[model samples]
Every structure is written in structure tokens, then in C-alpha cells.
Target: MRPTRAKITDAISAIERCFLRNQDGTNSVKDSTDSLSITEMTELLESLRGSIQRAVSVEQTRKPEFDIFLLTFQRWLLTDIARDQALLCDLLLPILNEALPPSASITPQTAPFVEKTLQFVRDTILRCSVAKDLIGKHMIGRLVATAVCVHASTMLKRQALDILNSLLAKSKENKALLTSHTCLTDLDNLVHLLKNAGDVELQTQLVELLFRICPKPKQERLQFIDTLHLPKIFADIRGDYFHQDCRAFLNQLNAGNDGVLKTPKSFRLSHAECVLGDTTSSLTLNPPDGADSLWLDFNTSSLSILVMIAGGDILSIELAFSKVQRWQVESSAGAFLPMTPIRI
Candidate 1:
């Protein structure tokens, strides 16, 4: 016999009332929180599952109404304004599998309903350690791939990334799934979007993801570096990697000014020399005392010489050279002259 619209509405209202009562301390539902002490949340979830299954199996011709009920149930699961239990997640699995076909045909009005269902699961995994563990055990890669393929939104994509990241972090047991080529490919594409899509928060989140997923070896770091031009992107964001304290000396040198004198002599140069030149040629101008270094400009010209002067009588001598050549003599200041002196 076909269930009337009024009957279905009443059932939905009853379930909603249970949900609200659970939240508001009424405890009307006979699940774990009430008289059905041994029943557990999982059992309640099973009952919901049986109901959805029976509704769907009644008749193929009645699918639309069944779908409506299923959609409403999903909406409640996602955003009931009450906390859901593990049983809800267990009940959701079969429904998710069954709802795929109908979800594909969902209208704009119904899209949020479907999306909220996915968001709820993701939020549960993120918010509760036990829920995350349950998802890591039961869902993880499978549902994540479904969400990524079915829900085409930047927000959903970000949520999927977050879920994957959390799963990978909490349970290193899923390394094979997390590191699979397909998963990595999706992550790579998402990282590209975050890095280039003008979304600062997304980019920040992606950076954290990268730190979590990227391996701890220098080779892996170099591999990531070679793949993306993060240095260039972060260069303008002063005090990032380029301006770290370890590289503060380099930043000062690039600023074309004598940086702090932690060392007796300092070099000042342009960005090009620091990034492109060899180590020997990229040294600081006025090399520190007892320091044998060359400070060459981008044009490969010596900027200054820091040779020891007797009794601390240091001389600041600027060589004027017109062409690329080497001087073969040492200056009176004990600095090495180029092999072939250039005309100045």
C-alpha cells in the first residue's frame, strides 16, 4: 500500500522532533540516550537505514516521493541544529550509495541539501576525534573522491582537501590511500588553485596541507620547490622564506646597503646576483676581516674589497673599470687583483 503524503510528512516531522528533543534534553527518542539503554546510537542508525531502504524498495513508480524523503532526511542529518551520533554516519553510507543517481539530477534548489550532507560528514570528521577515526576507518578516500567529483564548488573542494588532510594527519595508517597517484594529483591541482586563485585563506590552508603531506626529506622539498614557484610568489610578502632570520643577512645585502655589523665587513648587491650567481661571486662587498670572499655585482664586477689594513686603518677604494677584464696584481691593502685588469 502506498504511504500518503501526510503520513510521510508526519514521519519526517516525528524524526525531526526526535532530533530536536535530543538536543533540547527532552530525550524522547528511545535510542541510547533514553529507555533503550542497550540499543546504542548505531542501532538507531540501523532503524533509519531500514526505513530508507523500505521506502526506496516499495515501488519504482514511487521513487520521487522516496527521493523527497531521502533528501529531507539527508538535510536533517546535515543541518538539524543538533548533534548527530555515529549511528547517523553508519546509516548515511547506504543512503549515500543509493542517492548518487538522484543527486546527479538535483536541481539548484536541492543542491544545497546535497552539499550540506557532504559538509556535515566532513565537519563531523573534523570536529570529533572519534568521528574522524570512524571516517578514517570507513569513509576517507572513497567518500572524498565522490564529493570531489560530484560537488563542483571551490568551497566543497576546499572542504574535501581539509578532510583528506585531517585523515592523513590523524591516521598515518592510510598512507597508501593518501599518497596514491590520483589523490596526489587532486591535491596538486587543488594546491595550484589555492596558490593562484587569489584566495588568501584557501592559500593559507593549502600551505598547511602541503606541510603535512610533503615528505621530510630535502629531496622532497626540492621536488616541491621545482614544481612550484613559491619563492617568487612569497618574495613580495616580506619576512616570508626570502626574508627569514637565517636569510636576513641576504635580504640586507639585496637591499643595497651595509647591513648590521655582526661581521666586520658586509656586502651590498642587487637581487639578480644573489639568486643567479655562484657562491664565490655572490659574497658580501667589503668581506669580513680574515674572510676570503668575493662580492661581485650582477655584471660580475667587484663592488668592494675588505682586506685587513694595519692598525685598523681600512681604506675604501672603488675601482673604475670600463670592460670585463681581470687585474693580476694585489692592492697595497692585500686584496687580490684580477688576473687581467679591465680598463677604467
Candidate 2:
């Protein structure tokens, strides 16, 4: 017979009642189940997993038992029950993926549950070494990246990004694994979200993660950098907190490619100067106080410049350059600031 909602609720309630809050605010299983062996605990989770799988498949949206099930797991995690090997990865990871499938629609009611489930996963991984080990063993890097790059809910995306960062920080191999799994579409989605991201911390973390994965050798980077429109997005979003990272990313990409520079026709040189030493190089454009946009091309090397309304009324532009003999800047808006323009 199919599992009824009442039956699932009763099962979850029974599981929940097995744990009680201690005087120290920590949870512990009641004496009756406290002595349960690892095999018995695993069996209990397996039973709960079967109920959750069946119930969630039957009712994709608004299942109270599902909420209780996650809470029961969360409470269970707070106790010694979670320290056992393979229990978290074996039981929880499947339920996590089921709760937030990549293609599932995230209703407002469902969004909170999704966030809650992801939080549980993150917390489990962070607090339990055994669970962290499962991240690599199970190859769930792609699953976490999908949440970051494909999911619609910002809350869920943020949660997943945190989980991704934690895993990447712990394992060097995961950096390569995740980068290999990420495609052009994933990069495009990440850039799109960063462009519209209102949270400063989110933008910072996302940019840092992008930088970590994107700065490959010329052959590897040229495949996606141009296709994802990263340069255009970088140029467009300057003066935000991540401006330096954006500029540095471009410089890194430019350093790798040896092709001739491609300059747009609308660029007009106002001022360009090349200093020989290793301090830093900057391109300053003074566009008639209220000018809208500016374009410049470094024809000497493989660097192209595209600037938008950075800082809204500030016309000064600064960029770090290396090994370039010439810098050419052009303004379509107004006359240049009279600095000598250099050409390679």
C-alpha cells in the first residue's frame, strides 16, 4: 500500500521524540535508543529515507512530513548519531538532491524548505569530518555547482555557494574537479547573477570563486572568456566593490593571449602615458564632466578597453599593465585631457 500522509507524520514524530534537549541545550537520544549500534541507526535512517522518498515523489509540493523529516535529521545530526561513517553521505545526500532537483520549480512555499535542506547539508559537512570526506568520494561538486549556477532562488544559491566554498577550501582536488565540470552555460549564468547581485558579500564571494576557476592558460581560457562575454561584463560593472578583481581578471586573460589587439572604431584617444618602472600603470580619461561612456584600445598589446559610467561623475580610469610598450585611449564623448597618447 502507498504511504499515507498520516503514516509518514507518525513515523517522523516517533523519530523526533527519540531525541531530547539536554540542560546544556545540546540534544541526546533518550536512554532507550541511546545504546543503539551503528547498524541499528543506519537501519532506522534507511527506513526514514524510504518514507521520505515515496512521500516526496507522491507530493512534490507542501508536504508537512518532509519538513518534519528534515528537522528530525537536523536534530539527529546534533547528537553523536551523526558522527558515524557513511551515514550522512549514504542517507542525506540523496534526500538533499531529491529535495532540490535542478529543474524543479521553486515556489515561495518551497523555497524556504530548499534553503533549510541546503543549510542542513552545509552544516553537516562543516561540523562533521566524515561528512566532508563524502563530498569528494561522492563527487557532488557538480551538484553544488548546479545549485550555485542553475538554481533560481537566491537564498538557495547563496547556501550552495557557501557549501561549495567550504569544500573547495578543504580540498585542492575539488578546484580542478569543479572547473572541469563547469561549462560555458554555467559561467554565463554566474556572470549574469553577479551583474545583478545586490548583496555585496555575495558579489565578492562569487567573484573570488570565479577568479579561482577562470584564470587558466590561454588555450583553456579563450574557449569560454569571450563566449561568456566576461570582458564586456567586467567593463560594464567597474567601480563596484569587485572592480579590482574584474580588472585583474582581464589583465590575467590578456597576459595569456598573444594575438594582436582589437580596437573598436568609436574609441578616441584623450590621454595615454606609459611609465617604464614596476609601480603600476593607469589610463586616465577626463570626459567632459557629464560624458556617458568611453572606449579605449591598447593597440600595442592584446589589451582592449571598454569603460562605462564608473563612479557616476568621476572620469578618472586606472588599470594595471605589464610588458606593454604603448597605450591608446579614445573618447567618443568629448575632447581628451591633453596627455600624450602612446602607440606600440
Candidate 3:
């Protein structure tokens, strides 16, 4: 027999009472002295879950009223009284995901409610260890990613990114999930944000987050390379700025001079240079300091010829020719230039 409205309402009331009792410490679920029986709690949770599922399904196409019901359910779940938030989260996640497509036609006022419901779900997952544990095995990541892409706000996008980051930290399997269609699309959007965002602090956090989530081996390298297209999004300095240390590091790398410059052992650049040329002077190279400036009189149609240096030596060479795409140099040393901007 179909569940009556009274029956559903009664079930919801029972769950709400259980939540309230737990919060007031009168009916504590777990107590060293006198704990509530697990069987009783389990039965109540199952009943609540069933009733909520039915209610949401019954109200799915109802628009405004349905939205109100969902919001009520969401608010109740989020409030601390519902100590069994994990159980609610488990039941709600899939329903929310499935409900989204049909609700796409919902009115603007209802849309925010739907989105907020989803956000509540996401936030709950983040806050609850049990919910977080279940996320990798379910569609939570994909669901959150989808919501983020649909919503244009930076705040929502950041929430989505935080969920992904948490998932990645939870397990390797979650990291693999990130590359999936729904997650990847969201990531692409996030990458776009990181590339375009002008805020220094946000960019730094995003870059670091991207670096942390990036897979090891070739995938990590490839992702970093792709990020080069938008280089301005990351912060180059952390503490007191100094260029001398950077110059020294470059000089050490160049002469094959110390352990720091050893191939594959220390950071080394393949080429470095600072070249300047105009339309008339083909590509010409300026010699080292104190030496006659070497002029390459070769005629090239291009207006500019970049100075080239090899073997990753000389602070100046490292500063000038380092890849603008991958590396971000931040130093206050007097020897080297203030900051070298790399594309990657």
C-alpha cells in the first residue's frame, strides 16, 4: 500500500524527535553510561530515509511547493540535531543528482533553492567523515562538479573545488575519479578560473591545490605544462624578496660548478638568454659583459630575435632565457633580476 501523508509526516516527526533528543543529551545515541541501542537508531534512520525518498519523488515535478519541501528537508538534515547526518547524506546525494535534470526547468526562484539544496549536500559531505568516506564509491564528486559548472559564481566554484580536493586527499581512487567527464569538465572550468583570476591569494591557493591533486609521473608533468597558457595566476614570492639567491642558483647551475647543478640532481635549465632586436637588425646577440657585443647580422623578417643562452649557466642567462611557461621564480637577491616570469 502507498504510504499515507500522515504516515510520512509521522515518520519525519519521529526522526526529528530523535535528532532533538540526541542534541539535548537526553537521548544520546552513544553514551558510555547508557547508550541508545544501535538497533533502535538504525530502524528510525531507515524509516526516515524511506519516507524522505518517497516525499521527494512524489513532489519532484511540483515546482515551487516541491522546492519548499526539499529546502525544509535540507535544513533539517544540516542542523546539528540530526546526529545521523551521514545516513541522511547517503539517502539524499543520489536523489539530488537524479532530481537535477528534471528540475532544470525550474523557475529562477526555485533554481536557487535547488542549488542551495545541492550545496548543503556538498557541505555536509565535507563536514562528515562517514559521508566523505562514502563519496569515492558514489557519484557525489560528479554531482558537485556538475552543480559548480552550472553555477557561475566564484564562491560556488570554490566550494566545488574544495570538495574535489578533499576527495583526492581521501584516496587515490578519488583522484582517478577527478579525470572523469563530469569532474574533468569542472576541473577545466576551475583551471580556467585559476588562469584568469587576478587575486594573488586565490591564485596561489589554486596553483598549490592543482599541484597537490596532480597525478605522479607523466600526467603530473603534462598537466603542469598545460597550465602554462595562463602563467599570471600563480604567486612567485612567499617571503622577503631577493634576487641574489636566484642569480647564485643560476650561476651554480651554469658552470657545472657545484652539486646543485648536477644533471637530474639539481634544478638546471637547458637554455637562457636576453635578446633584443628591431626590424632592421636581423637576429643579433649581445656579448657577455665587458666583451664586444656579438652582432648576428642575419636578416629575418620577424621584428624581434630572442637572446639565447645554453647549459643553464650565469645568473643573467638563467634569468633571461628560463622557460616563461613552467617555472615561477621569486627572489630578492641583489645579483639576479627581481622576478623571472615563466610561462608554465
Q: Using Cα atoms with residue i matched to residue i, what is each candidate's TM-score against the true structure?
A: 0.44, 0.57, 0.45
By lDDT rank, best first, the candidates go: 2, 1, 3
Which model, 2 or 3, shows the larger lDDT? Answer: 2
Question: What is each predicted model's overall lDDT from 0 to 1?
Answer: 0.43, 0.54, 0.41
Candidate 2, residue 272: CA error in Å? 30
Candidate 3: where are CA atoms >4 Å away?
20-92, 96-108, 111-124, 127-133, 140-147, 150-152, 180-184, 193-209, 216-219, 227-344
Candidate 3, residue 260: how far the Cα is off, in Å: 45
Give the deviation of candidate 2 from the true structure as CA RMSD: 13.2
TM-score of 2: 0.57
lDDT of 1 by residue, 1-344 (tens): 55555665575555544433346675443243312222333444444554555444413223344454444444344432335555445555555534332323333444444455456555543554344555555555554453345435556556656666667775555545555665666555554554333222334445555555555566665565455444432222232452123123333323432222211123322211111122244322344555443233221233333243457343444433443233333332565533433232
Q: Candidate 3: lDDT over CA atoms?
A: 0.41
Q: Which ranges in model 1 have alpha carbons more than 4 Å from their true place?
A: 1-9, 15-90, 94-107, 122-133, 137-139, 142-151, 174-176, 195-198, 223-344
Lowest summed lDDT over 10 consecutive residues: which window, candidate 2? 257-266
Model 1 residue 42 CA deviation (Å) reads 6.0
Predictions: Cα RMSD each:
18.0, 13.2, 15.7
* Residue-by-residue lDDT tens digits, candidate 2, 1-344: 55556776786687677766666654454445554456766766666676665544524556677678777766666665457656767776666666565533455555656666677667655676564446654534444554554434656677767776677664656666656645445555666665444333355456666655654466555554566666634433333455444544444434432233331112334444444334476434444445544444333232334444546422434333354444444444445443233333
